[model samples]
Target: MSATAPTETQDLAPVRTESLAELLIATERPPRPSALSACLTFGWRAMLKIKHVPEQLFDVTAFPIMMVLMYTYLFGGALAGSPQEYIQYLLPGILVMSVVMITMYTGVSVNTDIEKGVFDRFRTLPIWRPSTMVGYLLGDALRYAIASVVILTVGLIMGFRPDGGLLGVVGGIAVLLVFSFAFSWIWTMFGLLLRTEKSVMGVSMMVIFPLTFLSDIFVKPETMPGWLQAFVNNNPITHVSSAVRALMDGTSPTTELMWTLGWVVLLVGVFGPVTMRLYNRK
Candidate 1:
């Protein structure tokens, strides 16, 4: 009888199911990160993006300087009789405008990450759910602080003085940051809801321009028409700007600050859950 050739299966070793199980069990799974730890980690990741692309800082630095200079000179003589005098009024409001305007980029960043599928990996992770969103805000909070400092520096060079002194300036910036952090939730929600980065930007501009310009950023709300003033008086930007201005002027901004904090609560309350829902679904 002719010897039969050994089949491929006959040469193979028996499968080691027990060995595989033992190997997997050998290494203990790492514990899950706390919410704060996860958020801080993602926040650091955002900072790393800035480190890789230093140009990311242009909005906070160069744009703020330009705003301080342009508005100080352009409307200074006409509005306040001189650039120096106008900077006194314009700096605080402009700081608010610059920072708030830049908050849109948070949404842009979120959208870009989504488009590139970065968030898909994030979603697969076992960390806290809202950490990613909170991380974006925390990173952008640094941008907001930088913008505030840049604007303040430019204003100082241009003869803008804060009557509130160091304490006042610090308080003003602190309040601005709080409001900005809260305000950013709106954009985060938009970022999750919108399909494209450009769409997110367009909608943000539409909403921000009306809120920033129609309020007291550039001109006194009282100068506007009665109907417009009605809206401006109620605008959240108005409260924030007024609060900052009052703080810098070394006065108690109780009413404005209360209104601003209320808006902060209202904004986060309304948009925070909606954003999380979208993030989960997305």
Candidate 2:
């Protein structure tokens, strides 16, 4: 009998089923988290990682100390006439260098995450795509802050002083953090474009070392050859170092600070898009 002629209610049951299916889908979908919240959550993840693996902090801790000592003693007498004199100039420059060098670790970490298929899990989640990178960028700022403190504390122990007072020191620290976050996009690009973490680390060092060492970090750029001096004068790191130096010394950092901030805009503007493109492709 049913085969012969199903009632209208029976015939429409499939439609009702389809409607409920759509309803289920509509209700089951979760709301997206705000971009800022997502970033902070991910930033928290990074901070927790530091807690579990305290050794992850070795670079920020040990490197800054080594650099402060090595540069202070190795070149102090010849360059600034004494370790004490050099520490003032050297500390600021080294603060910038320390933060810059540590930025590479972000790239390596990204690559490692990708290699392990961790990001595949991230993609399946409903969050802002850029948030992960932003999270890393923000979280690394904490690391940068740690490094800055390490450097400054070590410097103070070694008879270094910041004439800019606590305010200058605080201001310089803030700038270093902003600069580190901006510069990290370059390493993020490296992480995305490269296949392995080791390669990212290698390329990062190759680029970062020359920029840090060849600039006015440890000595006067005028002592460099004319050709070298020209490049050093234009180097973005040179501006960062100059700004940090001025800020820490209580001098007006307007000109150098402006230049350094400009570089921050440029780096983020250029690398930000490239990083996202490569990130999506990955």
Candidate 3:
């Protein structure tokens, strides 16, 4: 009988099996740690920029300090009790405002990246897909944290004391930072959607100005007319400001924190997806 035809494997006998080392080397790369690594790298870069520039820290730190002193020394008696008492009352609100202002840096940063074509380069890199947007937000959170600390330190120097103790102060700052992160997402969307940094600042000012004025920032919401009062009462900033005040005053848990967090969840849920979408388009 004729010998059976060689099997397919025998026909391909010249092929060499890969060594374990080669196999491991050629193995598919591990899944991208897009969010984590990107956040870390981008955040580290932000810190580095802050360290190098030094001047950028001025807006976040000095501006808030000046605002506190101006309000306390100039308008303190007109608005409330003595400057010391006003400092006590206003520091928390000012801190919240400081964090809110700090969030604008997110847009400024994005604009800078766009101008420098940094984001374009990012597209060429095999980075974690989620890192682009997550990295930005993470970087901003770090910046905001630093600004908040500096602002709080200045407030302390100016005789503003938080009666809630060290833990309370920590919690107060934490609350404001979380609120700022949530707020930053909204601005991030605006920044991404806009073509210029100045436009981002202008539009943001228009959007936030009314909200800030109507909230309990410079005055008690209850002191306003009914319509304004209703709006102020419903504003998320009002709740955040009130919650921060309560925390600074060493008061018990209030509905304001709960409300503020609820809004934070809602905004993050909405804008988190928006950021991902816009980031992908870029």
Q: Identify the leading candidate in terms of TM-score.
A: 1
Query: Which candidate do you rate higher for lDDT, 1 or 2?
Result: 1
> Is 2 or 3 the stronger prediction by lDDT?
2
* Residue pairs in collision within model 2: none
Candidate 1 lDDT by residue in tens digits, 167-260: 9999999999999999999999999899999999999999999899888888898789999999999999999999999999999999999999
Model 3 earns a TM-score of 0.85
* Deviation (Å) of 85 in candidate 2: 1.0
TM-score versus the correct structure, for each prediction:
0.93, 0.90, 0.85
Model 3 lDDT tens row, 179-269: 8878888877877888999998998888777877778888887678898998999998888889988887899756998999999999999
Please report, as a residue range, the 10-residue window in candidate 3 with the lowest summed lDDT: 9-18
Off by over 4 Å in 2: 1-29
Candidate 2 structure quality by residue, lDDT tens digits, 1-282:
356665565454346777778877875657789999999999988788889999999999998999999989999999889999989888999999989999999998889889999888988888998999998888888899999999999999999878899999898888888888899999999998999988998999999999998999988898889999988999999998898889889999899889989999999999999999888888
Stretches of candidate 3 exceeding 4 Å from the true structure? 1-31
Two-way TM-score contest, 1 vs 3, winner: 1
TM-score of 2: 0.90
